[model samples]
Target: MKNIYELVTMFHDVHPFVPSLSQFAECVVAYIGVFVIKSVFKHLVCLECLESLYSYLTDIRNYSLIARKSNDGLLFPAKDVI
Candidate 1:
């Protein structure tokens, strides 16, 4: 398995984790490939970026929780994971 800390560190340094408005605007422009998606593309891109950020944060949180429990010699129940 990959080192959880390494994964967390990598993601911590990534852009979307703490995005600026210009970065958000850039992402919107980057994802606007087709004419059909042009009108709502900015909103879609913003939402997608936020969703990705949320997903990554949740994964890190879950991994840290599991790691803490394991390090304390306790079992992390499957039911507690999302």
Candidate 2:
């Protein structure tokens, strides 16, 4: 999970404006959702796993907000203004 998050973060940092990044993130979340659903049906998922997945999703959302803000220059003070 940490690795996946890190990879996504790196991708976002490199290509923040790419539309495919959003699609990639959505696909990852969807894949996780399917895994969770299958695990639940098979009685393989535990409470801790669910909590961890929730935490991951929250982190992704927060990171996305940070990325957006950075793109808008809100995360860093302006160095040059005309």
Candidate 3:
């Protein structure tokens, strides 16, 4: 009943289309809490580890031209997303 760009923004309705969406949100929040708590509990862990993970898919992100030129090794197409 919705267009391709239209989205169900509510937490409850997502399950009709993808059954695990609600649970997936819960898991993400839980992981974010752990990431925050671990940063506070320890010495903020390794900043580089988080930074590198921020670009964890550096070579895999499609928006990067460098990814397109250099990422034939990655599984997804680097350019021509459409």
TM-score of 1: 0.20
Tens-digit lDDT track of model 2 for 1-82: 4798898888778844645457556544444454454455466456654444322232344234334434433221111110
Residue pairs with colliding backbones in model 3 are none
Cα lDDT tens digits, model 1, 1-82, are: 7699999999888877655456445333322312223333455657654333222222333335334334544322221122
Give TM per candidate.
Answer: 0.20, 0.26, 0.25
Residue 10 of model 3, lDDT score: 55
Pairs of residues at least 3 apart in sequence or in different chains that clash in candidate 1: none
76: Cα error in model 1, Å? 36
For model 3, where is the 10-residue window of minimal lDDT?
A: 73-82
Best by TM-score: 2
Candidate 2: 10-residue stretch with minimal lDDT: 73-82
TM-score of 2: 0.26
Ranking the candidates on TM-score from highest down gives 2, 3, 1
What order do candidates take by lDDT, descending? 2, 3, 1
lDDT of 3 by residue, 5-48 (tens): 56535544555674444544643443343345445436646775
Q: Which of the two candidates, 1 or 2, achieves a greater TM-score against the reference?
A: 2
- In model 2, state the lDDT of residue 36: 54
